[model samples]
Target chain A: MSHAVHSPARPSVSTQTPALEVHGLGKTFHIGGLFSSQAVRALHRVDLTIGRGEIVALVGESGSGKSTLARCVARLEKPSEGAILLDGIDVLKRDRFQASRTFRSQLQMVFQDPFGSLNAAHRIEHFLRRSLTIHGKGGTGQGSEAQTRRRLEELMTTVGLQADMLDSYPHELSGGQRQRVAIARALAVEPQVILADEPTSMLDVSVRIGVLNLMRKLRDEQGISMLYITHDLASARYLADRTAVMFAGEIVEEGESLDLLANPAHPYTQLLVSAVPDPARAGSYDPVHRARLRQAVMASTACAFEDDPHQRCSSEEPVRHQVGDPRNGHWVRCHLYRPGAGAGGHALATEPLPEPQPAA
Target chain B: MTVSQTSFGSHEPVLDVKNLTVKYIGDTRSTTAVDNVSFSIGAGEVFGLAGESGCGKSTIANSIMRLLKDPANVAAGSISFGGKDVLAMSQDELRRFRWQDVAMVFQSAMNSLNPVLTIGEQVADIFTTHAGYSRKESLRRAAQLLELVRIDPARLKSYPHQLSGGMRQRAVIAMAVALKPSLLILDEPTTALDVVVQQEIMAQIKDLQRELGFSVLFITHDMSLMVELSHRMAVMYGGRIVETAKAHDIYTTPRHPYTQALMGAFPPLTGPRVPLTGLPEGVKFHNIPDLAEVAPGHFVAPFDADAEAGVLEGAAQ
Candidate 1:
């Protein structure tokens, strides 16, 4: 079950200063109306931090609390527990005025449904104009009307949209263009962090790479932090520096993007990574591989994986244990990774996964 | 796999679509959705139509099924199923042909399945209506169909809402295959499901195709799935078939710039980092040159673009 994490010595950049920190976040939804007592745990005590100008991808299957976590951070839904601290300030603990004004100004959310989210009756200019006017933050660029116009043009240019597109309605633009407009709107506020939830899932496959490049540019050039949430792992590996795998309502594994994808420790993560239909890795996704994945447990009350040894998965809780060698700070939340209690700490983390055989 | 065997020397294909052009007839302007597309699905062959949205991949599939309504019609095309002219079929003949001859599994499983009806009832309904079987016999067949998709036969009595997303998709597949259709048209069939479930569904589709020997017209924007599943694939762009070749050839050694871009658009999960940057927005592939045989079995469209444009400008090279 051990898959060796492979990557050359990464350029060690100082990740001392944190941009955003989330501690023990959780959200639960009540099933019925106010009358019923049944509740579903959508998110559990999730903890992670985004470094300055870093892109951390939150990957999972549907109903895996990925969207729920992004929503909680975006403040679309109130977190039932935990704190969302931006620059050491607990945004959730702030007052209503602070939450809307001070909290919202620093963080922006780029939605998946770009066309549906924007008003069909308004032009593209209206969307950006309203955002810059409302949350531009004094002296940050949009000081006067003329400055606002220039800033809007700059935002449009940054996102690879034309100046004439500002006059066009949302419906007039193609699906890809509307998405670029949505991304431009997120950048207009000069936010320090962007919570993009499946922004390119609805766009064309040809244009999806363009948007991902734009996102990478945003992180590298603008020095903006991001929590890119999606079900697609391939895209994440392309755009993100680090990745956190979520299952049900918990973060099962997290590490450097290439390391995590090349060597997924958690069973669910392994299944997802292997499930990607790579022509090069065709042997790994054959019928026998599919059968192994389909028979995996769904919505288990115990630990998420079926490969939990020591039986502590069903009896007790699983905590995140740091992986050794090649994966400096990589963590996996499985009983197998537990030290001394199991087969020892990262004892089997040596063998490199079977390389793809040349296509027959 | 058997489809390639038939394509090697056979003259009569399972599904033959020639010069299929679909257009939206507006009052002022008419825009082509699918134009001059030609392809054939050999017996037991999983032929794929690979393209991005609005490239008219779905339009071609719908034209084959005769499911296009007003505003969207087959402007010029010839569809033949095993030597029978589908375009010349009468309204009654079309009704009898659909589902019995070719079954369509739509993009959304929830929208495809009848929410009000139970799984067993829906599967039985298809059998009774098409095959004219008795209720008891139809249901007995329904249970067997449901089991084919690996769904619990006991859950056949459960509603569509009762099943999970993956289960609902399996139920829809079970229902589509109830009459043992010769061809299956799947448009992004497993796009909504997660990767793990998608693998399961794909495995089932392949298993069923091998057992039943049905030709599949698999339409999706996912190039990786095309590479892994299809025996032969046609790359579509700007409503035209840009390239056609063996699936492996198309993935590994694409000739057309559009085909290369489409393949490069999908990032490999585990490989050397190869960033994909597509063609410029101003590049028009509408007036591409005639399809030329680049290799023995591979066909590619010639281009008249300069060095600064098309596949030359991006990471596809």
Candidate 2:
């Protein structure tokens, strides 16, 4: 692909360890009282890796467990199972009860709601200074105050905000400006990895691109890895180097962002790609077809492609199958891609499905 | 007015707004939220009003519904629905006109719904209040409305929290169309919904519109969704319409600098990846001149020579 040539900021393949690596990450929530508690599986064996300077986008609907995965990685929620490796070191095993200061400094998280994340009482500078002091970056000496001031200004500049805004409260700034301040606070600790969960979803459409660009700039210049969790496929395609599509608490498809979206292997991913509003494409909204597809997707417990006769997709869990070139890192968790499923299944997996027809 | 006449030449206009201005007055200062905005929705057409927050899209919707509270007053304008002046309606007449002639679906369906009551009770309340139907008849009609929006009639007894976000929105839509209103104003109806659910809701709205034949004032910040659903659209910026045209024409060739910047904000899913700077830093197209008909049905606010040169330079990158 010409992405290498066009995107000079793309990190080359290096022998250095990945910034974040998640293996068999799973989370299950217990609901109701102790008499008869119900176990709800929020995540299931999610395996992901983000290289230094790479942005991997996790895309899914509200209940698809994308946020849960991010929470697990950020240590907000303790994963039920699996290991989390930060810079090839297993931090989960080391710090069982609480996240160590090193782990906190190395991995920071930016939440969705900028309005709710920041304290209303504190000024923008207070948040950044707190992060710096908590991480031991801000010193107590006389010259240290100037050093901290310079660092705060640098952080503000990195996130494309003016130093004068440091005095403003959360309520005084606009949604976009508040989000930039949030990013600056995350950057205050000089994190190696940042888990951004729907960072720009709450911001205005015109301002969303600015935040996405800032994220890319951070990855390119600082070599910081990022896990961008969002439901918007178009934004993920624009910002992420790779995309992993989650469906019903599982990764349905994973590959290079453009390649996966352009040639979606999983039925769920196909549905998502088709559902995204594309102005260029002719309007295709068949209510009946959409209803049937929604029903099928919701009804399936193990796999989305439950109609596949060769494989029992409704009951049996689908395994990951490589699609196209192995080096492309394109794969799908679908029964259709299973080995020896049949010629028909193989053809279905290879050729993309036709777009839904517009209403008559 | 000429632009409306050209666009709605075949179909009759359901809602006509002319020189509409809404201002929020403070003790010492007054700020215009909707500044001399004008547009008309043809019968059975989806007319989209798109802009960022605080651009006065919602203010226009509120003015049309006469739901503006204290401090927010209609400064100047005439809003006519089927040749009847909306601003001149009496309180009693306005109450009847609201649900019987026009209905609105707010941004958040969850907030719109009464959490303490069942879906059936909420839907039935509209019919009982406006249509003067008996409780039994209204309940039956509520079940039918639920079915129309693809929600199970059994869920009629369920609370708003029991249903998903998409279903909650559908329930709201079902309620809005219960009285068979001539106009339905949806203010960011599916903004809180997921992509798939949003598509489904849009499709459902399209199907309902086709069946019932009601004009829609679909307001949202998402231009892609707006283009997909709207027949004609007006792009708002700084309390003024910057561009107005057919959905296809606006998508293909946007003339206004704000419209162009908005179009560039959306990155394509299946195209060459390029970094797009959405809006230039600190660039505001404020206090623009009136819209001039650039094409047959296309209307664009003509920027002055100095501002035009600057905006073009800023947006062109």
Query: Largest TM-score belongs to which candidate?
Result: 2
Error of 1 at B69 (Å): 2.6
Candidate 2's DockQ is 0.55
lDDT of 2 by residue, A1-360 (tens): 222222233345343678889998888888668886656777777789887778999997777788889898889899999999998889889899878899999899999999999999999999999999999898677899999999998899888888988998999998889999988888888888899999998888878998999998888777778999998999999999899988756777899898899888766677787788887776665545554444334333345445555434323455666667777799877633221111111111111234322111
Measured against the true chain A, the candidates' chain A TM-scores are 0.81, 0.84
- The parts of candidate 1 lying over 4 Å away from their true place are A1-17, A32-35, A96-98, A136-143, A286-315, A326-328, A336-360, B1-11, B304-317
Q: Which candidate number maximizes DockQ?
A: 2
Q: Candidate 1 at residue A220, lDDT?
A: 68
List, residue by residue over B201-282, the lDDT tens digit for candidate 1: 8878988988887889999999888878899998888888889999999988987767766677777687776766754454
Can you tell me which runs of candidate 2 are displaced by over 4 Å? A1-15, A287-317, A336-360, B1-11, B281-283, B304-309, B312-317
* Candidate 1 similarity to native, TM-score: 0.86
Q: How far off is model 2, as Cα RMSD?
A: 6.3
Quote the positional error of residue B120 for candidate 1 in Å. 3.5
Docking class of 1: acceptable
